[model samples]
Target: MLRKIIHIDMDAFYASIEQRDNPEYRGKPVAVGYGGKRGVVAAASYEARQYGVHSAMASVTALRKCPHLIFVMPRFEVYKTVSNQIMQIFREYTDKVEPLSLDEAFLDVTENKKVMEFATQIAKEIKQKIHCQTRLTASAGVSYNKFLAKIASDYNKPNGLYVITPEKAEKFLEKLGIEKFFGVGRVTAHRMHELGIRNGFDLKQHSEKELVHHFGKAGALYHQFARGIDEREVESEYVRKSLGAEETFAEDLHELVDLLRALDDIAREVHRRAEKRGFLAKTVTLKIKYADFAVVTRSRTVVNYLRTYDQLFDIGKELLLQVDDIEERKIRLMGLTLKNAGTDQVVLTNQPLQLTLEFKE
Candidate 1:
């Protein structure tokens, strides 16, 4: 039997919530984040996207793109509340729901509580309930597997629904751009271009052995994706691997005092989040990105779990001091992370939906 999957992606989740709550923001270009010189955009409304304003872009750059863009500080607590409401609605249909983030999730409705015969109907109902209850719209994609379902959801825009049946999956994939394939980032896509792989048809021309030699293990997955084959299941039990935060400075820092001060702030924020999430780990890692974009990291694994803010900060300070030529090189960004002593589980941070799903799968 084919597995029924539906991928639900909220349209500009943070920006939409703001618009739904505040009448003044509706139909205007809005970005959710600080507008300071050092600020980065967390989310951008579709209107703002038209002007090339997007999340992770510098606030200064976003403003340059859309001079009238409005900036609003993030309200995570309120977003979480709305997310819970959405998750409860998913539970109403199926227990096999895998949340990719606060905004999107994947539901295995093959054996749903509603005993729905068609996956498209389930996706339609879910989208309706979300809009009716929260006054925010969602786009849904339905198919036999997670990959097609995820791509289907994004096929349509806000308040849209799309389905990729088994019969159509092959032709649809053949015409799909190489960039749309799973695990294909900018760098990988560039390499594929050099090899003349522009679309799924081009990728299909390569044998698994040749692809594996080019992309290592990931090449094998690409070979499968070209054929519209994704065997991964919708995982409901997600274990967070690490917790941390990073900040990019508008101005580079070369002084030891400034670097230490920045590390202290990052350590404090990481500790606060860890405490809030009850995430405990024995290893602390410090990351440094130089003004020239060169990156380096230092880590230390202690016998005892880092439980106190002081402990996390002290370890972070030690790691920072251990970096090579820290005082000589100008630093553009600093980050702190906590993880288990000897595990290599992938970490899921707030990245683009494509990048996040790459790690989740």
Candidate 2:
């Protein structure tokens, strides 16, 4: 029997929450983040998005796009509370709910507690509950698999609902842009374009062998995606792969002293969060972005879980020095992350590690 999957995505999660709680922010362009020289936009309201402001954009850049954009500092604790409320609503329908983030999740409602005959109805009810309970809107997509369900959810916008039935999945995917396929980033899209692959239909023309040869193992997945095939299940057991924090500097740093100081601050925050979550890991990764926007990363693994702030900072400093010409290159951003090193979570060889980065804007 085909599965019934529903993907629910909250509309403009952070920014929407702010607007819902603050009547004055409603219908106005609002951005959630610090409006400082070193700040990044964590989330942008739909109004702000109309002006090209988006999440992960520099605060200055967002301001330049929309000078009247209202900046609000993120209240993470409040967001978490709302997220929990939403998750509870998901649990009311099915235990097979896989959360991609606090704002979005995938639900396997084929055997839901409510025993709903149609996943679309489940999605509609869930969306209604969320809005009624939280005073916020959510968009939902329903399909027989995770891929189509996720894509359907995004096909429409805030407060929208869409369904991609099995009958039309292939034709729908054929017309979809190549860039819309999951795991295809800007770099991958450029490579696919060079090979004359611009849409799902062009992608279907290539054999699995040819695609695998061109894009490695991920190419095989792309071949399946073009045919509207995704066998991945909704993994309800949330296993966090990695956690990290990053900060961009107001000005580039070339001095070793300043770099180390920045690393120290970031490490301290990472340790605090890890300690709070009881996330013990044995690997440390350091990411650096140069002034020219080039990025590089270094990682060190140990046998024991890193338990202290000093341990995190010490490893971070070591990784910092490992970077080439640490003192000569101007660095724009730095990040530190901790991974399980295959100790805490079951390692899936076929899956890539997902790192969640909390930007300190």
Among all candidates shown, the one with the greatest lDDT? 2
RMSD of each predicted structure: 4.4, 3.1
Off by over 4 Å in 1: 341-361
Give model 2's clash tally: 0
Q: Per-residue lDDT for 1-361 in model 1, tens only? A: 9999999999999999999999999999999988987778989999999999998898999999999999998887798889889988999998887888889999899999998899899999999999999999999999998888988998888788999999999999999999988789999999999999999999999999999999999999999988889999987766576778888876899999988888788887888877776677898988898988799999999997788999998999888888888788899888888888334343433222221100000
Model 1 misses residue 297 by how many Å? 2.2
List the candidate 2 regions with Cα displacement exceeding 4 Å: 344-361
What TM-score would every model get versus the actual structure?
0.91, 0.93
lDDT of 2 by residue, 281-309 (tens): 89999999998989999999998888899
Q: What is the lDDT of candidate 2?
A: 0.88
CA lDDT scores, all candidates in order: 0.86, 0.88
Q: Candidate 2 clashing pairs? A: none
- Under the 3 Å rule for N, CA and C atoms, how many clashes does model 1 have? 0
